[model samples]
Target: MKHRFFPAVAALLAFGAAHAAPCPRDAPLPSGFERWAHPGLGVAAWQESGTYQATLPLGRAVTLHLPDIGTVHFIVPPGGKGSHGPYGGMIGIDVPSGATYRVMLSGRAWIDMVQDRADLPSSAHQHGPDCTGIAKIVSFPLHAGWHVLQISGAPDPTITVMMSSTP
Candidate 1:
């Protein structure tokens, strides 16, 4: 009987690969997290839900500092290596509390000389039109603890900062 219909089509493909539905678990990575390269006091933390991975050293130009807050920023451009920076860089943050944010980048962004550059303290700027600091396209808004993500240009890009969970 065709091997009993291949075991019922392999048990319906293992029940559709275990329901095949996730991503609601929320991302959260920040606890003894360590991935040193130039830890000259480098910061790459996440909470509310988490995921973190920062590895730099291909050309040399890395920066990630966000001690606490809602937090936001993500850039992963190494797919086929198109010379590197075609566009991807700019961030000025600071959010002590009341969290909420998201951002991911690869190409397309705006900012002059990287204003704020991760000093974010003037009451944690977040005042209109999505904070209005010039964040091309990615995802952003984070406050509560620290949020100082300042990624620039492209040299050793290994950006992957995912976070979701603020309830």
Candidate 2:
């Protein structure tokens, strides 16, 4: 009986360890995410209810505050739908030059890039490095100009985001 119980105890312990809490908010980011180390910007979501526009700079992290999904006016319909909740928003990004850029998010959310009134499909998608605060990373080939980043179906009202040109 003791031997059999030991296996169960060990399995429970392993599961607990595997589900440890996310890294501290101030913890240093992984190598590719170092650009997010700087101070993060806090901005509200742009919704159809009002005339609001927010811009996020590349290579800097921003804490975006999203409104209810029903309130957001995405430039283009999001490719992915939100599951956790109705929290979603949009922010503008100015790409200095045409290049592949990576967008990092701290939580699960749908990301869509729009330019010239069209949706730009993601070029690649991957998970963040272990122990990094990032939960997902999506890459897109962008051109130099203004673009809209639509965030939808976030589980929470706020999410941390960072974008940087791939080296």
Candidate 3:
């Protein structure tokens, strides 16, 4: 089991690197958030530190740089389902529409993306050789509209979630 661990980690690292951009180290505030919060850009990157909700435009790719430690939960409303995942790496988001929104999550986590409140995610990526440090990229099809993105379950007192445009 241990022998294969090294190779597995290597593969995960490579996979993460390939999809590194589009998800930078800073999570952008909802367009004009400064008018109210006045926190400034990069100030509210972590999930626990500041503003956790942001509105993503249609067909924009963004990256949320997760903390180096702890578990994280990303919940999208309508279904109000939250995906519990591991710490570190980046989460890529490309929103063409809710039905075509793409979410790429790395590290240890459980993804339960459900379009309907009753139906569960068709698949899940668990922690292991292929999913170590980060899991596979999962896409969820939801309704077209502004969906509230929520984050939680960070072991650390504070953690940053970065968002950037994807190329």
Each candidate structure's TM-score, on Cα atoms with residue i matched to residue i, is: 0.22, 0.83, 0.32
Q: Highest TM-score: which candidate?
A: 2
Poorest stretch of ten by lDDT in candidate 1: 106-115
- lDDT by residue for model 1 over 1-167, one digit each (tens)? 99999999999999999888653443332231222122232344332112223322211223444332223343322122333343233232334455444332222322111112233222122211222222232333444543334444333333333222222
Backbone clashes under 3 angstroms, per model: 24, 1, 20
Tens-digit lDDT string for candidate 3 (1-167): 99999999999999999986563334453442212222122221233223324333333333344454343333332222243333422122333444434333333233333322233353322221231222334444455433333333333333322222222
Off by over 4 Å in 1: 18-87, 95-148, 151-167
Worst 10 residues of 3 by lDDT: 35-44
lDDT scores in order: 0.33, 0.81, 0.35
Quote model 2's TM-score.
0.83
Cα deviation of 142, candidate 3, in Å: 1.4
Model 3 vs. true fold: TM = 0.32
**1 against 3, candidate with superior lDDT:** 3
Candidate number achieving the greatest lDDT relative to the actual structure = 2
Q: Encode model 2's per-residue lDDT on 64-162: one tens digit a residue.
A: 778888877777877884355678888888789999999999899999888888999899999887777688999999999988888888889999998
